[model samples]
Target: MTGDHEPLPPGGRELPALDGGLPLIGHGIPFFRDPVGFLARVHSSRGEAVAFSLPGRRMASFCGPQANALILGLQDDTEVDRHLFYDPLLAPLLGPGVGLTAPSELMKWQHSLLLPLLRRDALTRHIPVMFDEVERYVAPWDGHGTFDLLAVMRDLSARIAACCLIGPRFGRTMGPALPRLLGRLEAALFAFAVIGPRGPLPHGLADRARETLVHAIKEIAPRDCPEGSERSHFEELMRATGPGGSSLDEDTAAALMVNWLFAAVPTTALAAWTGVLVLQHPQWLPVLRAEQEAAFADYPPTTLSALHKLERLSHCLLEAERLHPPIVVLPRPAARDLNIHGYRVPRGYVVCASPGLSHRLTSVFRRPEAFDPDRYLPDRAEHRTTPQALIGFGGGRHPCLGATLAQQTIKVIWSALLRAFDFELADPEVREARTTVMRLPRRPCTVRYRRRKR
Candidate 1:
């Protein structure tokens, strides 16, 4: 009955404790092997919030909707402790300023500059450019009967984000080199498992990738500033935070650019691929297509507003996000002592609110296992009851700043594809790729597309 701040019980089950999993490895193995199943077992047995450990760390898992609300609300107090995972993994490739590690004030300034560029007006100006790029990329598909949509979507999202982040000319010029840079960075991140006490091997490949990105960024630096118009967000960040101002320096900028890829590319690609796979379910496609057609009836058909009008399409995406979130577990280390649901959590303990498990709870979502978009429709309005439960974009102050822009980009791409082609899953056994970090569709996920008949 007490709020999250209420004092914990003296010595009962309410005391700071660890539950589930083995002694040292803790729950790391099973939790990664089958996250949903593991969390279900823990929640059913231990009640809403249960304590568990991972390797050298002690953490608590929160299962209920209330727990999600409580955790997300603390975003301001809890700066993202990137060191535990992101820092160690990504530091080799992306120096530092890319994500949560950037000095707080610099991040805020950069975000403010970036937000306006992703606003409705800016999106309107950029759709034609985005659509043009998509068309060029997909143009070769005519002769290719079957191709992995996963790779194609990844390439598409990365290129589009690059264009939006820099400018059309710069994005196009660097487009060919991007996939290589991304591959190198990904390899470095994957190499973390083997990065022993000797420390990560020189990582020459990752270093070269960073160099390539810096050269590309410098090549595209504004030749002559347009009258009255300021520099691009990336340029602004470099100038303000560069050697002179906050002076982030070239290596830092390269790292920040790599971080930009990490922040936007894979996650957006995953959402796009998942949206496609979800649409493959025979029952859902027709409804989604109809909704798309109706929404575009009077509008320019490619505008941001037109894409937003596809209520069912957006709902279907929300459902897909609920079912297969790109980032599953959000970990936070307590800065000070805290009490939650009668349990005391001491300082430095990690606590996680998993969208992967929480979104599947029937208490928060009706028929939580099924792909039912109507559950989020205005009439049902299930997500409204507990918005934090839908934490696909995280929550509170640190909520994914790129969320709206990501959604708008996804919707536009989906709209263009659906309008031009009829697509169905080419492989019978398509499955989602699972990693401790990001979720994506497994490779060789081919989609058969044909020109839609009028």
Candidate 2:
């Protein structure tokens, strides 16, 4: 409704729905109640693409690596339109021809504008920003203390995201409020996807949150760095132009920043879960510490090169991401008719894939559910076999834009934690990660820590 995409012609074969459902409402109630659990059950039974039991909508749920590749790649092309799915939920937030809700050409343009921030050398320098954030974050845990790892990591992730992505000055001045504001908008995509656009949503709350961030974004005065000086991703977006040198409007630019921060805040799930998993598997601490010592000896832990040398720690982070992916289901709309995995998928039907489900396939992962970082190691590299095998950060051409930043943030935080203190779980209970928004621990992952004697 928000974008200028064409309407679907009402003449396509209906996809088969998942079993066990009420009469009229179908499986809407259960699907809304737990999107990930419902999808897991669906993935278990269905071969590739299976329809969810919701009555009004026709969504084809795809599982496994092949399915993930098919949908994530095909959904944005000729037959499928990415905007049709995103615009309903996100149009109100990102607007037309901007970021996720934009058409292919426009989306690519906006992406190109943002790409300068992720340049190789630029990302290398960002490690210190993350390290500094983590250093200040865990400083309060003096001699001994107990705290919720998830909560602590979320706050720390927000600070790093603000400082590194938004701008160092703005992050310091206005960083504290980004989490609460951005949190309101985090669930909009999936909530709207499952419940439908007309379904119950805190429209007023999200609107207010978006406006507050936009207001803050607009406050910063534009500065000229002359020629080759550095600029934050926020500043880059603020000055960047779109098609034919046409500058993005103020709200559009703010929407782009909002999108970036959205990825940073709640999706800090990776950094948070990485800490939780390492704590849960205390056996790996020595291995991580040894690698840390070696890495730091060569190039101080503050540098990006040092973090890159932490291959084992990085693998653990990847394993944690594999086990607890940020988002459960990725769904997109078909603008025109297409065939998916031998099924005749009609135009307007939504096609979806679950990173949570796909990542846990026994065929794909050895000891799928366990914290086995060696799965990514050279000897038993299970994830390397398939194209979209490890889809925690998406696959095909639409991989997560912030995947590198998320990984760097995790590295910096964990390296700092491992070096500065000794941590032990307050409650030695290991909670399994679930398929849901953020995919972090619902219950408290509390831990006790003491300042390490250097």
Candidate 3:
């Protein structure tokens, strides 16, 4: 906790902070071992805003609704940079231009072009594609058998996201190569702590993956005038910006796609599996099933528009996000010196905001730990107390661009599954995957599926 002392801001709060353990490691052990429990304990004892030292770096964690808002609001500040954490893992996959590392101007431009595709009109256009993909993915499930839902979700989402990002043909053409690319990328990320820029093992795998990714990118790259272009977002982005109306080069595009995979794949899988896990709860299943039945009765069961009407299902997903946020801790580096609750945060220090901890504050959510979807209903609107309190998709200028897409995809898959089969968890005590930063399921979440009685 060694740093230059400065006077606290007037009328600001000063609080106790954690001095992390050991040299080099800092609080990495406790953080990775039991992140949720560790954070919860810290908040209980230290209050909402606390500071900690990790490997000579000082960090302040904001755990309440107020802190969440402040951190997210800072996203648009030229001083606040997201690249510190995002660049290392995403650069090789999504290219430098697509992820946080891309120049801020390019990121803004890309966002503008891509926003329409995710808007209501574009979402409407894509619904049929989503439903068709969902039906295809679930077609193989037997009514009386058990299967791993996690694997099912990963494959399904990768394919669906591929369809949305590139096009149906590109998704199909690249199918055989997708898994290997994903595996290599995942391994590289896991090995990142040990792998230096010149490290033999990490560099070797990254190089190979980059080659495959580049080839795939070229295959999907735009050739003709970008009308009804599935890859138009990328082409239009290039054509409308920078030198020759283009900015991100091939490698950057590849890296950005890789970053997109990291962003979209695991989170989508976890959200889908979490929905399934929630459905397995005997009490909630009946209510959810009833909602599904009613939503389907009024409109065709297979369309996206119909699924949008399933407000109860949306609430269930929201509740799941609240209870088990896929990324429990959102880490951002300070772009400039700033004061949070009177505590001085110097530039380069990493600041953390934990949704897993903040979402449980009873101050904002009644029975915060309970899985009560009704709490999110418009009338209750408990989360409206603070914008930061309900940031499942994050907040501010850098908030997840794919949030709507992720939500829509999850709802579509769940709706299809519930309509087709009755399911339950194969194991009662199956735990979620908890790494230092990301939280997901450990393996294929097995569930027994039986035909629903019509």
The model with the greatest TM-score is 2
* Candidate 3 per-residue C-alpha lDDT over 1-454 given as tens digits, one digit per residue, 9 for 90 to 100: 1123232332344546676466765775666666778888877788777776543355678788767766766643444667766676556534556646667777776556567667886776676677777777667666599887666776667767767765576566677467557656666655553232335686667778867766776667454222265545456545555534666665555555555555555555456546665755667777777877777764335456677777877887888788777676777787776676456676776777887787888989999867788897889988886777777777754578888888887877776777778888887555666531345566666878897776
Tens digits of per-residue lDDT, candidate 2, 1-454, equal 1022333344444566677777756787776666667788776676566886564556788787876777777635765777666777786654456677786777888888767667787687677677777777767666988887877777778777767666766566665577766666665544555455665564565678888887777775133221245654556666776677877777778777777777775456787778778888889999999988888864334466777889999899888878888776777777767666656677778787888788888988888879998888888889999878988888776888878878887888888888888999877765543333565676678888888998
**Over the stretch 179-287, how does candidate 1's per-residue lDDT look in tens digits?**
6567566656545523421244536766777777877776664442222346665556566642236565655655565666656554554555555656567677777
TM-score of each: 0.86, 0.89, 0.87
lDDT of 2 at 256: 76
Predict model 1's lDDT versus the native. Answer: 0.66
Which should have the higher TM-score, number 2 or number 3? 2
Which has the greatest lDDT? 2
Q: Model 2 Cα displacement at 199 (Å)? A: 5.8
The worst-scoring run of ten residues by lDDT in candidate 2 lies at 1-10
Candidate 2 collision pairs: none
* Reference-based lDDT, each prediction: 0.66, 0.72, 0.67
Off by over 4 Å in 2: 1-15, 22-25, 75-77, 94-96, 187-194, 199-201, 221-235, 298-302, 430-436
Error of 2 at 384 (Å): 0.7
